[model samples]
Target: MQKLFSLTLFLFTFSLSQAQNKFGNPEVDPVQIQKTYEQWSVYQNKNIMLSRDFTALDVSSKEITKEVFLDQLANGSFIPIRLKSDASVYYYKLFKIQPKTDTSIKATINQIGFDAYKNYKMEGTVFPKFSFKDLDGNLVTNESMKGKIIVIKCWYIHCTPCIKEFPQVNKLVEEYKDRKDIIFISLAEDSPEELKTFLARKPLSYAVIPDMKEYMNEALQLNSFPTHFILNKKGLISKVLPNFESLEVALAKESKF
Candidate 1:
C-alpha cells in the first residue's frame, strides 16, 4: 500500500502540470484537473485513494474510472511506471505505452529502479551469507543452498503486483517440484501472523520466510518489492529480474548448466 501511495504522488504531479499531453493532442479540462488535484492533495500520504477518490482523465482524454483501472492493473494489462528516489523526493518515469492506443496510466507497485538497490550489479556476484527460519521452522542458510539453483522472491502482502503474480510463481514451483537441484524461496517483510492469515487466503508455493525486513533492507539492500534473484550452483547470482517471465527464461537457461 505504501508503494501505491508513492505512485499516486507521481501520477498527481503529472496530472496537475499544464504540460502538453504525451498521448496525442487531447484537450484536457484544466478546471476539472485542478479540482481533482486539490481533492487528491488532501489525501496525499494520508490514505490510499488511487481507485476512485478523485475523477481524472488519462492521457487519451478518457475518464479513468475505478473499476476499469483496477481491473487493468490486476490483469497486468497496464504498463508499469519505473521510480527513482533521492534523500528528499521521489522521481518516476513513465514507460512507453503499448499498442499506442491504451490510455490508462498505472505505476509499478513497490518497484524502484535498479540503481536504487545497493547491490545493483547483482549478476555474477555472490549472494550475501545469511541464516533464517521459514514459517515451518526450517533453517535455511547460504551454505545449505550451495550446489543448487536457488530462486528467491522479495515481496510483501499488500503489494498488488506481487500478489498478481502468485499464480504464475506457483506454476513455476509446480513445474520444478520434481527437480532436486532447484529450490524456490520467498522472503516477506510481513510478520508471521500477517503472513499466516494472508497465505491462508492465497497460498504461495515458495518456502515462506516472515519478518525479513531487516535482512531485505540491510543485507540485501533492496528498495523494491516483487524483485527476484536466481543463483547458480556456485552460489553466484546468475540473474536478477523484475518480472516472472524473465525469471522463467533465466531458470530454463540455468537448469541446463
Candidate 2:
C-alpha cells in the first residue's frame, strides 16, 4: 500500500492549547471530514497526534460523535492510528488516546483488536447474495460466483483513491487473464452512462456493474469507498482489504494461484 503522507511534520504541527480553544461538538459533515482526510491523509501510519478538533468519519462516511469517539478510544473501533515504533505499520485499528490530559492525543494502535474486528466483520462470513447487471447486460449473482474465487471492488466515480487504483487493479486483472477459476468485478455507484464516459478515458479490466449504491450500502454495509472483498470458492469472504496490494495478497492466498 502507498504511504499517504509526506515526511513534513510542520504542515500538521499544532499546539495542544491552540486545539483546545478551537474544540467544538463533532458535526456530521461528510464533506468536511473528507476534505480533512484528504488534506492530512488521516488514515496513514505516522508518528503524530491529532488535535481534539480533528474530525474523523466512520466506515459509513458518517462523522463519529465526540462522546462516541471518546468511548471508542477506551473500547475498540476501526479508526486511524499508528502502532508502536517497532510494530508493523497499520492504518486503521483499535486506538486508545494517550496522555488523557492533553488536547492532542497520541493514538496507540491495538493490533489484536483490529484482527478481532476483521474476523467478526469479514472473515469466514458468507458474501451477501447480490444480483447485478453489468454494462454489457450480463447478470452476475452469488449463485454464479460460487465454485470460483471472486475479487469484488466497491467504489464510486468521484472517489479519488478509487480512481487512483484503477491502473493497478487493471494490472491485477491482466495478470490473471488466463485463470478460469477466478473472477474480478467492480460495483460502481455511478450510472452506466457516467461509467461509460469515465471508462472511455480511463479503462478498467474488471467486469463493471454500475449504479450499485443500494447493494453497496444495504447488502455490504460498507463504511468506506474503494473497499475490496475477496471471496473463496464457497462465496465466503476471506478478506476485506483497503487497498489493491492487500487484495492481491489475499487473492493469491485464497486461490493458490
Candidate 3:
C-alpha cells in the first residue's frame, strides 16, 4: 500500500547565478522553485490537486509514502529522502500528475530523479573542461591541469570522509606531481584564508580550490559529498566515485580512463 501527500519544498543555495546545477536538486534552488504549492487539506484528498515526482538513491526496496517521507526530510535530519519503491513501481501509484513538462521544478525533478532512483555507474559524457583556484589563491586553469589524471574531489571542510581522505590523497599528489599524469584536489566552499594556516603546514603538492562549491558542483555534476569525478588526459569526466574509499576503488580504477 502507498500514500501520496502534499510536499513541503525547501531550497538550499548551491552557487552564484553562474554555478552549475550539480545536485539535481532543482526544487531546492529558490531561483528555480515554486514560492507556493497547493497545500493538502486532508490525508485523503478525494480530489487530486497536482502531481510531482519524489526521488532518492535507494538500497532498500520498500514503499514509503510522499507525506511520510517529506516530514522526515524536514524533521529527521538523520534520514535523507528515500523511496521505499523501485523501478517497477508505477508512477500513478506514487502520485497523479499532468505531463512532466508542466513546471520548472517538475521538469528538474524528472531530469534528476531519472538518475537518482537507479543504480548507476558513473560513465558518461559531461562537461570536460575544468578549472579552479589552487591553494595559493591564484586562479588555476584546466591548461595547468594538462597531461594529468585529475581527481577532483568536490568537498567542503566539514565533510568527514573528505578530511579522512586528505592524507592518502596528498600522498598520491606528492608521488605524482612531477609525472604530469595524476592530480588530487580538495575543493571547498570556504575562503582560502580560512584554510591558509591549515594548508601552509600541509603544503599540498597538487591543488586546492576554495570557495568554489557552487561553480565546481555545477561544473562537475556533483551531488554526493566527497564526490570524486576523475578526468582523464582528454579532460573529460571519466568516472564518478562517491563517499569514502570503501566505495571508491572500483570507481577509481574505472574513471582512470
- Ranked by lDDT, the better of candidates 1 and 3 is 1
Ranking the candidates on TM-score from highest down gives 2, 1, 3
For each candidate, the alpha-carbon lDDT, in order, equals 0.65, 0.63, 0.47
How does candidate 2 fare on TM-score?
A: 0.61
Query: Of the candidates shown, which would achieve the greatest lDDT relative to the real structure?
Result: 1
Tens digit per residue, CA lDDT, model 2, 1-84: 133354344345544334432423222232232334333244432322221123543443345653344345435533443322
Specify the poorest-scoring 10-residue window by lDDT in model 3: 41-50
Number of the predicted model whose TM-score against the real structure is largest: 2
lDDT order of candidates, best first? 1, 2, 3
lDDT by residue (1-257, candidate 1, tens digit) is 99999999999888856342432231222223223434323332232223112333333434554334434434443322212223232222222234432132223321222221223356679898979999999999999988999999999999998999999999999999999999999999999999999999999999999999898899887766688888899999887776676678678878899
95 in model 2: Cα distance from truth in Å?
9.6
Off by over 4 Å in 1: 1-120
